[model samples]
Target: MTPDHPKSRRSFSDFLLHLHPRTIPEENLRLTLSWGLGGMAVMLVCLLFLTGILLLLTYQPSTGSAYASIVTLTREVRFGLWIRNIHHWSANLLVVIAMLHLLRIVLTGAFGQGRRLNWIIGLFLLFLLLSANFTGYLLPWDQLAYWAVTICTSMLGYIPVGGLWLQELFRGGAEIGPATLSNFCVLHVAFIPATLFVLLLWHFWLVRRAGGLVQVEHDNPDDVPVQRVPTVPNLIVREAAVGLVLVAFILILAIVWDAPLMEQANPGMSPNPAKAPWYFLGFQELLLHLHPVFASFLWPLLGVAALLWVPFWQDSALPTGVWFGSNSGRRLVIWTATVGALTTLAIILADNLLLQSNAAVAVDTLVTRGLLPTALLIALLVGFYFLLVKGLKYTRAEAVMAGIVLVLVALAVCTIIGVWFRGAEMHLVWL
Candidate 1:
């Protein structure tokens, strides 16, 4: 037998304390909080990976074989159906958790101070996560996936100069074909994951270095106290618990129902009441009410520009972590509301535009319309910006009023885009 060493007798607790240089407190709330979400994110990623690997064994990426392979996985392979369900749900869950995490940071004002870079990276991660889901959605080669991509890629047409070329790059052709499927598959499987993994590492590293936001800090420096606990165990525990609960729920769902597989995708057949994915449904609903050019292109572009320019709009008025003393809090709330409203309006426009027009019901002719609506949209954006950024006085009430107006404007724009796309009569199924 090997001789007993003095260090070995000290136990795991002794080793942990030595490494951390901080005591593991009897009650470490910080650790508990951090671990909860972190663990959930990890578990969800693992679940997605495992399911995706299993799916790859059965999935065929070719245009001809793609739908058939999915059908086979659902009908023939044992537990294959369950695995797919888990995969689908996990993708959605990942998006949801990431959004919640972003919200948590914002609501707590944790993104102020030293964590701004992390906030930007977190936002980019959210965008990439959404992109991953979108790519994966198209792989099934179903009606819903088909139309969703059609409308989504169609929006790329709004880009200046090289918009058409960029759209072509996405489609790999004029329509959905082998190239589109293969490219999206590669992105969903490899590109997205690689980017996410790198950014996530940077994100966590920032979190570890800066410390998980001053979760319960007082605005007044006199009232603020130094945090004592190192976040590790308790945080992990909470994250694990949330993840376990989610996994249990997902497993039960998988056991009860198989993944949904629609028709074999006959390109010629038109489903009269075709729909986009539920999330995009709000946008599709926009098409029923708004003018295609204005609603679809100009309005949406302005909305994105507005989001990117928010920090700049505030200028140099407030310093980092300075939430109070000025009207910043109210202004921030207004800003968030404006963005949310803009998103909602975009949806409404999609739903209601072309409801009364002769060409409205058709799904193939959206692009043929003239430049008037588009020009009007551009003009409206310029007018709105002038009013919101220049004309409106910088006050709490002004901010509140601006937010309300933004919501209405955005909803209208999205509704218009939806109507324009749906009315084209192309038999698109974005669901």
Candidate 2:
């Protein structure tokens, strides 16, 4: 109202410019530094740096001598066991902790409003994490590592047009051989790491520009004002705490239990029941139960398409002032979850029963060679989609549905682990 006031004029300009002022609360910022993802990310990056340095000293990424070099490192090099342990554990921890950090962001609802791009970056980070882990898995040169890569590459056959080519690229040949191992090792230790480093730097730069986590929705200034702390000091403390704990634990595990090394890979011998890594075994399971069109192509395609459409599920055809939950939006989420869980349970039970039945017992000549298992896998994935779409009409809570679906998926995973453990005990190699 004061037309001539300097402060009033500046305030008007600020409003017109769409600017908002925020005072940095030192205590709040300091606390953010203490526990936020910034600390976690720094710890993971540090682990990568230290362990990667150690790995570079001994790792020989070549087709002819890579496995032999690893053997030499374990048997001959000084403290080489520790170095390998650090590299293995650091890679595993990086992925696990990064997921945790992403979950923290999601639970805190920090992905809403202007932070959508941050969420996208986090998703890309997850993809990179998986790529990094997958590449690393191929480096150990054990049976588990070798055939696991083979099984995974084979899954690309489900891709529509270029699946075969993609699979070849992964193998670096028409089949899994020394070239595949060497190529993967290079990507793991060299190329992927370089890209990861660049992306990580970009991610942090974005974080800095965006500022840290938004205040929790439940926080009330009248109740207790939040605190803000500077990034440097708090990072030094909290990251040291988490990083040291993780590193020490891995060191102890490595010292006590050497990583499993199955017999040197032999492409000529197909073991009784070869399996991929656990993360991919579920997918491998899918290949058992359906036709290629249903198993490899349509199912994965649809699953991903469903995930992409999630944000739009409750929205109308055109943007409107109506709220997302004005109708049965939340109810729909619950029904989706309920249906997914039920279908997964059915498919898993069916698979286990079939595997243990007389049909599996007989193990006819051709079927035993691996076609039966592959067909069973295709069936499983198709069955999963069939059951998932069954409960679209229910009314329930989103959280409840998500929890139920999670439980079902976990149960199926546990079942697979049980099967693997039994096979492992029998010394029956399957991969």
Each prediction's RMSD over C-alphas, in Å, is 6.7, 10.2
lDDT of 2 by residue, 192-281 (tens): 778777777676556545554454333356787556554344533555576677667777877876655676666766555677665555
Cα shift from native, residue 178, model 1 (Å): 0.8
lDDT, candidate 2, residue 266?
67
Output the TM-score of candidate 1.
0.70
Encode model 1's per-residue lDDT on 57-94: one tens digit a residue: 99999888888899889889998888899999888778
Best by lDDT: 1
State the lDDT at 322 in candidate 2: 20
Cα RMSD for candidate 1?
Answer: 6.7
Candidate 1 segments exceeding 4 Å error:
1-42, 219-224, 291-297, 312-431
* TM-scores of all predicted structures: 0.70, 0.69
lDDT at position 377, candidate 2? 48
Candidate 2, residue 243: the lDDT equals 62
Candidate 2 has its poorest 10 consecutive residues by lDDT at 315-324
Q: Model 2, stretches more than 4 Å misplaced?
A: 1-38, 218-226, 292-298, 302-346, 354-431
Model 2: how far residue 284 lies from native, Å: 2.0
